[model samples]
Target: MSKQKKLRKADAATIRRVLALIAPYRLSVAATLVLAAVTVISTLYAPVLTGQGVDLIVGPGDVDFAALITLGVQLLVTILITVTAQWVMNLVNNRITFQVVRDIRVKAFEHMQVLPLSYMDAHRPGDAISRITTDVEQFSDGLLMGFTQLFTGVLTILGTLGIMLVIEWRIALIVVLLTPLSIFVARFIAEHTYSMFKVQSETRAEMTSLVEELVGNEHLVRAFGYESRAEERFEKINLDLQRCGIRAVFYSSISNPATRFVNSLVYAAVGVIGAFLAIGGSITVGGLYAFLNYANQYTKPFNDISSVMTELQNALACAQRVFDLIDEDPIRPDAPDAKVLPHGAGKVEFDHVKFRYVPDVPLIEDMCLKAEPGQRIALVGPTGCGKTTLVNLLMRFYEINGGSLRVDGQPIDTVTRDSLRANFGMVLQETWLKAGTIAENIAYGKPDATREEIIAAAKQARAHSFICRMPNGYDTVISEDGGNISQGQKQLLCIARVMLRRPPILILDEATSSIDTRTEILVQSAFEELMKGRTSFIVAHRLSTIKNADCILVMKAGNIIERGTHEELLARGGFYAQLYQSQFARS
Candidate 1:
């Protein structure tokens, strides 16, 4: 309904989720609470002991030496216990806070792995990275502050109030009357600032995403001469973040001073009333002194808590982002009684298959095809003609909207996704190589492959010569995304990875597009060897690449207009022939 109501609901949910994360470490939490209590009790009792010691000295010589000595010893002991408990409590709090944060980050990452590709396509990589990293760090800082400061503040406040009442009800009543002022001030500031802090968190995520996008594509920005425009764009986002941050801090900062001012009034009232009570013999000097100490102690936690509230608000906002990631709906699970696809003949059938990325947009409709065992089915088409989409469907990255896709006569949906995907080796035009040695990259698809196997695969992909030239050869470590190597090298590594797997089916989506013509010919020969007996689905824009394919399906606007051998399609003098002629036509 209202923003306030929404904020309240969100805060409640975040707190509940945070508590759930902490639940597994309940023993540590319980210990922290016990130590907090012990710290507070021992701390509060010291003032009483001090007051007694003060009363013990009527005059310089009128002091009771034996009794004063014992009081002093007891107060010393109480202070030591307070310090020790507080130190141990901090240790437990640190452990619990960090452990919970670690769990949240882990769960968020695990969830991301199972999330559908559509989810990643819909969200920015930078934003997702921010949630698991920057946001989680913020959440950790906030949780730690709450554990270290907020708990102690609350316990101190309650403990002091109880001790104050016992020492002098009249002065304690004054504090009780003024207590609501501090709370109201903190609550008023907190409610207004929570929304601002949430805005700040969102803005921070946007900045993170922008920075990542710009930095990762700096070459493209420079190539387009967009340096000035890129700077302007970045400045705009940074300004928004600055504005949100400033407003959030300005509003949250008000609570501390506002609560401090209220608590000061409470403190002054207690001191004035306590002094009069001592003067009129309504309370002892020692008792009045204890009441004053309790009054100050009681009010100080309000100040500490008010400050902690600002941090908690920011923390809760960040926690909400992380929890959102953790709660995202994962990819649809495999069917009940789903069987693993056994390694059989590579016979794939698409029967009246229908699909679309968006429900309202028609992409592939009533599409049907079949690949007998060991046949190479090349998909040639214009951009957005569903060539790549077709390959994605075969891999089950996206399920067909209608009709059945079968691998060896068994409907693919009936098989576990892992098994179905395991049967196909894929290499796309856009290659991915993790930060590791060249050998490790080649052995990615088959982690248990031996050194000889990795070397053989690399040689097959025409990458072994280049690999051997590197300083460390197979052990040379590559930077992230293989930035240390050429694009062709990265693609070769990817191809080598797939070759190592040697799956029953292959999907090469412009897999050799990055290599030079000479290298392409070599890799093509390798592919010919690799595809000798496997059903291959090749998505290519270059007509020459698929000229020798067993069958070429020429597609346009989401439908296949022609399908036949390359020679047969060309002889038909149809769409396929026109496309082939256009590719090699004289200028």
Candidate 2:
């Protein structure tokens, strides 16, 4: 299809989707339309009343003073009703616009929860945030403008035309024939500006992403002396946005004046035709005056609509982005008869698993492992050797291409994901703590945990001493990401969270890497207590920490190169020994 045809098709689809979203508020929409009709009809009747008053005042003292006074009162009542109805209509429009925006934002966020991790890895978080927040705000503005102006404009035009035709059909026909000129000009300019607006929206999203990235990593930027480079990068995107914005605004701005010029011609035609008719005595002077007023009213809507076309174009563009996010493919759902994972001895088995992120580029191929009940399995590997990938697959964060993973002899996929995940507790190298009290952070996995239970878990994770040192102890509030605490303290809080869960299986991926050597010794002892009789998988680089593990698996390039006890691996003098010696040699 041609580009113009495609844009028109997309615009139609966007309108349909927006209408679908607004379907629940049909009653309010109907009320707004009724109010608009009342407002327009009242506004049109005022001009008719003025014309009658003029007719009553004929040739100085020949005027009917009583009739003029009555008409003036009627005009005043009509104006008041018009103002009141318009005010109510605006309130309804605001409610609908903001409600629609809220629904869209909420729906977008809900969809994000189900979206695949790969989707998140492939897109910038700031861009997603912009679509939900910034883009939705833009859509609300456009929707409000359309509801406020477009509805009234259309009703006014139609009402004025009907009134004009009743007084004088000839003038009405002249106005009708000339009015299409305004529409044609508006359509031509609006079509050209739509693509520019789309470009501008996309550029704005890119700018948002860049700013978020730079600001979030401000410390790193300055520490690495990257301020100048960062500024240059930001300036480049800023310039692109400026150029796109200017072109869009400039093109859209042409629509208003071009349509206004056409409307002016229609008004001029009605005036000249009405004058001749009144002079020829085919119409009363008062009737001719009302027709001229109706003619101006008929053309005024076109100007109002043309002026709002720019906002509508930009709104539709942003709406499309939001809808695109809502329509992203979510993670695959579980089977119809998926069962909840039952609590049992943790026996995890990976049977000939094969997986890769990019097609045809193998990362973990033909991998097989089995962890028996109450065993501590340690995984040691160089970077990019599929260590963390194993943890992700175990947690079902990503599906393996060819695999049958089982937990306690039941296929992992046979159980609901939430149920399967509840069987394991995880603590990672990167710690995360939401803004809350230290006790709350510790009891995150178990919200109903008591204060005593929270304190006990903290003690088990070797974090209780530091927790007591805080100003309010367990009651003290911390910021998100634990900005007020040390990195070691944050890691301890994360460990305490897992301790509180006490799941059947545990996955510790460099869980103690952030702590100091002294604290590491204490936390490691606590981990030993936590791991008793529970299946644990440890991914670590420091070989000393795993010296007493039940089994150690040395990995290289997605395959296990060695599996044995620490003494057995060292006696063999293989890759494991070299890796172990390399770390100690550095010390």
Candidate 3:
């Protein structure tokens, strides 16, 4: 696997694409923004009232009762309005954020379905899960909170600044100049912190993969005495993840306190300047007091804006990772103009087909073979000699690198994958069963199969006798991957599934290799019945298994070296004859 690269800062195009996902909720977002603005306006009024109340109490005459009461009531009303607006904004933000996260997760999973098998083979399952869970959660929390605080902070700053300038421009000028310095400091910190977040995400994904691997293969780990090694590997990943997380937190942690310190200095400067202006008789005492209050209010928004700026950068890093996955091109299937395979008569022809899993290592080279309807063709080869590769090509798991293969005289490439695969039945060496009842596993290939049909298929595979002997018979619940059953039984269940499908073409890849000799005899008899009217491709390591095949093809080093009926090949004394003699001679 290739090493994952660090996440780059998102560009304008990527940001625009992320924003497009929320376009459908524009009206709700607008309402939330309006509420945020109203709340900011109401909050700004509280500090102004404090100044008014101070002036009212300090008036030359006896305390102005009417003025005091009026100011107090206005402050109370503004506080109530501010609280109500905040409540509404929170409700709206939560609703919108949840919906956005839901849509992102659903789309990611749906896209996985259309991706090519090669893409999945290259990525770890746990890493993919981390993207959907941890990364998305981070995005939702940071984006929703940052957007709300940002809008409110800007509105609050504008309202406070306008009031401050009206009372005294000099004090406001000091605040305006000092605010940019704080923003500059925040931007610098965020730039450095963003890199740390990217590292943290990758390290976390690695840790998740390690845990998944250990859990999925616990039995093998214990059998191989790998507990200590697994723990050591996990500890290394954990330490790396911790280091990355610490760096990210440390960089972001500086922003809040730094902003507060800068705001404190600006507030002091406003107080000193306001006192000088009042002494000079350029402003009334009441106006100077109000200007001082508005100065503090102005700096408060700057502090909030600076804090959110740091958080937004982290979210942008995560969004970059998410959008990168979403933007990958899904594999294209056959086009609408592609020809549909006619109802196949079970004839299969490989016309000079060639294939390679990687660029330089060819698995099949200039291979050609033909099987008439109902013919049983056996493919015999040493390990990695391309027997399984042939079956994979016939199923179109990977497209041919060169030449053509046809079924019933039609080129396989022209047919839709679904249409071609629908007519084939396969039994792999390793049987995989989901966590369900025995009946359900057998009926997996044909979900609409009747109960009687399922029972018949199981009987035909010679699995019905053992299945009936189980406590619950066909209703017996299998564990995931059929872990509760023996390896041979799992293979039998898979055979039963393929029998249920009853397709015109059958491919068996080491299908009976797991069973005992006696059980193999029973399965072989049932398989003969299944292959009676269908073209079949059988791959077996044991020569005894394929001795009765209509024709046997011997393969070596990606090329067919010999082909003949069993007796003819034995009499010819070629590679097949030698392999058979060596194997059976030992037994």
Top-scoring candidate (lDDT): 2
Candidates ranked by TM-score, best first? Answer: 1, 2, 3
Q: What is the Cα-based lDDT of residue 206 in candidate 1?
A: 86
lDDT of 3 by residue, 1-587 (tens): 22222223243454576688788888888998899889988987787787777767775776888988889899899999999999999888888888888898788878877777677878888888887888888888777877678878888889998888877787788888888878887877876887788788888878888898899889999999999999999999999998989989988889888888998999899888888888899876777777777777788876777667667766666766777677777867787788777558889888898898888976787999999999999999789898988887888877888998988887888888887898789999978999999999999978999989999999999999999998899999999999899999999999999999889999998899899999999999999899998999999888888988999999998899999899999999999988988887775
* Clashing residue pairs found in predicted model 1: none
lDDT of each: 0.90, 0.91, 0.85
User: What is the lDDT ranking, best to worst?
Assistant: 2, 1, 3
lDDT at 46, model 1: 90
Model 2: per-residue lDDT, tens digit, 1-587?
99899999999999999999999999999999999999999999988998887788747878998998899899999999999999999999999999999999999999999999999999998889889989999899999999999999999998998888888888889888988888888888778877888888888889899999998778899999999999999999999999999999888888878887888898788778888998899888788778778877888889889877778888999999999999999999999999999777999999999889999887888888999999999999899998999999999999989978999999888999998899999999999999999988998889999998999999999999999999999999999889899999999999999999899999999999999999999999999999999999999999989999999999988988899989999999999999999988775
**Residue 531 error, candidate 3, Å:** 1.9
Which segments of model 3 are wrong by more than 4 Å?
1-9, 59-61, 64-73, 278-293, 436-440, 462-479, 484-486, 516-519
Residue range 1-587, candidate 1, lDDT tens digits: 98789889999999998988999999998898899999999989998888888889857779898998899889889989999999999999999989998899999999998999989899989889999999999889889988998888899998998877777777788899999999899888888877888888888888889889989888999999999998998899899999999999999888878888897898788878878888899988888888888888898988888888888898999989888888889988999999999877999999999999999999999898999999999998788898988888988888899999999989999999999989999999998999999998899878999999999999999999999999999999999899999999999999999999999999999998999999999999999999998999998888889988999998988898899999999999999888888988887
Q: Which residue pairs does candidate 3 place in steric collision?
A: none
Name the lDDT of candidate 1. Answer: 0.90
